[model samples]
Target chain A: MSAALLSAEALRIGYRGTSMLPELSFAVAPGTVISIVGHNGSGKSTLLKTILGLTPKLGGEIRIRRDARLGYVPQRETMDPIYPVTVGELVETGRYGIRGVGRRLTPPDRARVREMLEATGTARLERRLFRTLSGGEQQRALLARALCAEPSVLVLDEPTASMDEKGAHEAMGLTLALARKHGAAIVMVNHFIDLVAEVSDQVIHLDRDHQRVTIGPPAEVLKGRGSQGRYSS
Target chain B: MSEKLALFAASWELWRGAVAAGVVAGAVCGFVGIYVVLHRIVFVSAAMSQVSSLGVMLAFWLVQAQAIETAHHSEDILPLLFAALFTGVFSAAMAGHASARLSDRTKSSEAFIGSVYLLSSAALVLVGDQVTRGAHDVANILFGNTVIVDLPHLLLFAGVSLPIAVLHVWLRKDLLFVSFDPVMATTLGYPVTWLRVLLLVSLGMVISIGTRTIGALPVFSFSVLPPIAALALFENLRSSFWASAVIGALSAFLGYVTSFLLGLPTGASMAATAGVFLLVAKGLQRLRD
Candidate 1:
């Protein structure tokens, strides 16, 4: 496989010193997609937080290429709408990650912000208040914000959890095209098993009750573990 | 109106330092208040102000007990140092454990803040009673209606506030990002913890000096009211920062002038002026809706 952008070896994840799942090993190469699929009680969020360095790792090691930058797309509902930010301004903040503090975002940065919004099909809504957008639009805007950072690895948390069927598929398609176009690795946490099977290059299936983590191709995982009711809702 | 203006101008030499102090302190508090209001930690401001008041009382008590005679009211700044130290420690605690985190919300945590407020309020009175010059002096400084501003305090207020204002500007986006989306800020490699500590430390300094200069009522008002007034009218947060600063400076200056004219208390007058602006802003917001 190509040089991995992110890899975890015998990674133990949980709160404090306790392990939530069996030790796992995986590597995500550039220009590929890996999905962490689990139900509500599973430790997918803990795992994601550990990877993002928001939470401390319990044991083992997670490595990333030295030059890699991680772009995060948070869930739409997680962002409070009370802030008076335009969609354009919301996307503009993504450049803050790239530009750091104090330094202004150059013209190229502004152009890139506009470009990402256009790519996500939210360009026309740039002037509108971000809070006024529907849930699906907010999700797309978040995606645009993540891409605006031009990260080497893009982490999306429940990217399609709030979208309708059509919007969800459209978002997945965009994710694939953009991943290939930018050569960025995609690590997504998703509850929808069917969608994960279709879009992911590798799937990590999590079972909370049994403290199980199954990692394999989507077809083998789905057939062996049976498709979860993620989309049945 | 002209007569009042003329009276104020005649006393300009006496009042110039105070008016300057008001404007500088008002601008800093107003600007930082944006984060204070947005992050919903106005309680932190209130608690810090009370704690600083306690510090002021402690300074006056110590001077009286030791019979320390200071030149040109050097005793006044003794209170300032005491206040800064007290409030600095309080703000550090707030920033480290809860206030700066912004997202940390729990009843027990709020209870801790509320306890600080009550204890400081009670302690200021107790400490004041021990000052031989009369608690009235300490009370006057802590919550009085009028201000007799002098050169040294004015210079001190400006010296501290001006740098903080510049720091806020230089670090505006970083502060805004943390206040708005701290988790994302953390993921993007920004020093979220240090930024938060810096924010609260800056806030503590402003509140301590502003309380020493204009009294707690106006300081608290300046730190909260203007940002709220700005938020009600502006659809953009950055625009609100500018508006809040303008409103804060205006309210402070107007309150000082009007207090001198109408024989009212300066701190309350300033607070009332800001309150009036808040009412107008809310009215305008309703109309817009």
Candidate 2:
């Protein structure tokens, strides 16, 4: 197997020194989609945060490729709309890491931002205030911001939370296309079991009652697991 | 008005110090205030200003107790140092508290800030009573005597303000990213905690030294109102930053001129002028909408 883009061994994730999920291990590879599914408070988001080093890991070894760059599309609700930034300006910030500090966005950076905006279908909304965009639009803009960084690992938490069925499907299609084109690894926390089973190559299901995690191909794990208990619709 | 202008122009050397001080204070406050308003930590700034004032009063009391000659320019160092120290400690504490993940049962952070403000205000009064010889000196500490701004004070303000302004400009995007979306900033490998601490510390240092030169009220006003006005006027953050700095500088110059012509308190006039700019910006935004 090609080297895993990201790997976790006996990972324990939580906040304030308390582990919410059972010990888990997984590896993600380029051009592969790994969907994390669980009930509320089942450490789905915590796991993503832990992997991204946003939260503390009680005991775990998370190893990313030395040169892997990360792009994150955080939960839409977590971002405050009170911030005064235009869609273009907000998306332009993704270039900061690549461009380094104290330097203005070069032509290439602006070109990338424009390309991402176009890819995300937010080209028309570039000049609009970020706060004025609807939830679905904001989600798309945020995805554009993340993609503009040209990250090797793209992690998203509920990318379709505010999107409708059609919007969500379209967004996922675009994401899949982008991943294939860029050869990036995608790790997402998703609640929709059907969608997870459809789009993800691998699925990690967290059974809160049993305090256990089941990881395997979507066909093997999600089969006959129709909408019951924590996986219930 | 003409006669006042002639007098003001004739004694340009006399008032130049105050003008320089006002412009520097305005620019620094304008730059820092964007973060303050965007981060929605206005109360933290207020608390910081109050703590800084208390630091100044404590320094004055210590100087009086030691019977040190206040006339010497070197004496100003003691108060500035104390203010910076006190403000730094308070800013660190506030930053830590704000970053903490507390239980729902704990008192909100605003309550803690309020308590700090109340305690600092009362302490300032108590310290002023013991240290200051009369009400005039207390007024000078609270509101600042713009006329007393000499070349040394102007140089000090410039020395502090320039570097901070440069840092803000150079790190504008990183700072904005950290302030607006810390989670994403961290995910991108930016040190969110350190950036936040740096921002708070810089704010404290600015308020500390600026308050010593321009009084707490004007510093607080300049740090808040101009950013708000700029936000009302501009759609983009970068434009808002530049516009805020310009508005702050203009407000200060116009306010000083108003103070000279109308025989009003300089700090209060500057604050009022900033308020006017905010109102005008709001009106313009409304009309555009």
Candidate 3:
């Protein structure tokens, strides 16, 4: 089998000396979209944070297969509104990792930013300050920022949690398009069941007890456990 | 008439130093102020300025008078440098240690900075009382005499301010990232804590050197008001930086002109000009809003 693009082995997460989630293992394959579905307090957010190395892990090892560039959009509510940056500036900042310091962006970096902005439907809003945008607009702008980096694996934490229904659908469509068009590995922590069922290629349901219940396809995942109902429901 | 011209020429020479000081001070303040305002570290700036006063007083307490003719400028500056380096490092270290240990549970950082500020100011007063022969010289250091900003001080200001200006320009985007979203900065692999520490040290040096022309009191305005004024009008990072420079330079020029015309205190007049600029900028921003 081809090597996974991004893989985590025996990951353990915690806060204040207490383990919130037990040792877990997962891998994200290139061009695949994996949606992590779980109830509240199921350590979904912790899992994402651990993958990004935001907090010190209790125990685990994560390896990126191809020295893959990583991009992430944090939860909407966690972003500060007081940040004084326009969408274009925010998107262009993604090039920081690529360009390093004392070097101006070449034609390619500039083109990448523009293309990402266009793809994310934020081309017209590029000049607008981030905090002034509506929730959905800000979310799209952040995605544009991520895409500017040309990330191999794009991870998002509840991108749709604060958005309205229409916004949620639009965001999911954009995310799926990014995965398809760029061959990016997409991992998202999602609370909504219907949305994941509609878009995800693979569904992994997490339990409060930190057990992984691998649900095969949208048809099987949407069906409630022990229910005799058909997939049409 | 030629006497008036001579006075004008002398005053013009003084004006050059004042303008130079203002530009260097303004540039340093603008760079440091962006992060200061972004991080909500106004108290840190205040602590730094207060601690800087102790540096001056300690210099006076340490330096001794020598023969009048051979008064080397370096001899005078040596103690000030030592005092500045010592007090600045000490206060910053204390604040860092206290914040790391006690800030999570109790409001230790604020308390620590406040206590240091008070202690430094009290120490300055006691040192002033004890050192009588250099009372006027101490006052000059406190509220600098711009009329006499010599070559050595000018070189010193440039030495400290130029590196800060270059770093700010080079790291403009990175600094902007940390200023905007520190969490995002970290995830993107920028070291946030180290950047902050570097900023603190650079800010201390900037204010220490700038204390010569603008004096201790006006240095606060030179550090804060220009950035505030720039933010009032501009939206982009580059534009904001340019606007801040213009505001800072204009305030300094106008302040010098005001003092020259009315025989007012130069430092206070400069600060008043910056304050008025801030008010006008605020009013315009309100109109736009």
Off by over 4 Å in 2: A227-233, B67-71, B97-112
Model 2 score (lDDT)? 0.84
Q: For model 3, how does the per-residue alpha-carbon lDDT over A1-233 read when each residue is reduced to its tens digit? A: 43788887887776666776557777887888778776777777777777776666788788876568788887767666655778888898887777764467888999999998999889999889888888888888888888777788898888887665677787889888886798788888876667777777777666656455554565676567422211110
For candidate 2, lDDT tens digit of each residue in A33-110?
999887777778778878888667889799988878889998888888778778998899888878765668999999
Error of 1 at B157 (Å): 0.4
Ordering by TM-score: 1, 2, 3
Please list the residue runs of candidate 1 whose C-alpha ends up more than 4 Å from where it truly belongs after superposition. A224-228, A231-233, B67-74, B98-109
Regions of model 3 farther than 4 Å from truth:
A37-42, A201-233, B1-10, B64-74, B83-119, B122-147, B191-194
- Deviation from native of the Cα of residue B9 in model 1, angstroms: 3.0
DockQ of each: 0.60, 0.52, 0.27
Which pairs clash inside model 3? none
Q: Using DockQ as the measure, which candidate wins?
A: 1
Q: How many residue pairs clash per model?
A: 2, 0, 0
lDDT of each: 0.84, 0.84, 0.71
| Interface root-mean-square deviation, candidate 1 | 2.3
Model 1, position B193, has a per-residue lDDT of 77
The model with the greater lDDT, 1 or 3, is: 1
TM-score of each: 0.93, 0.93, 0.84
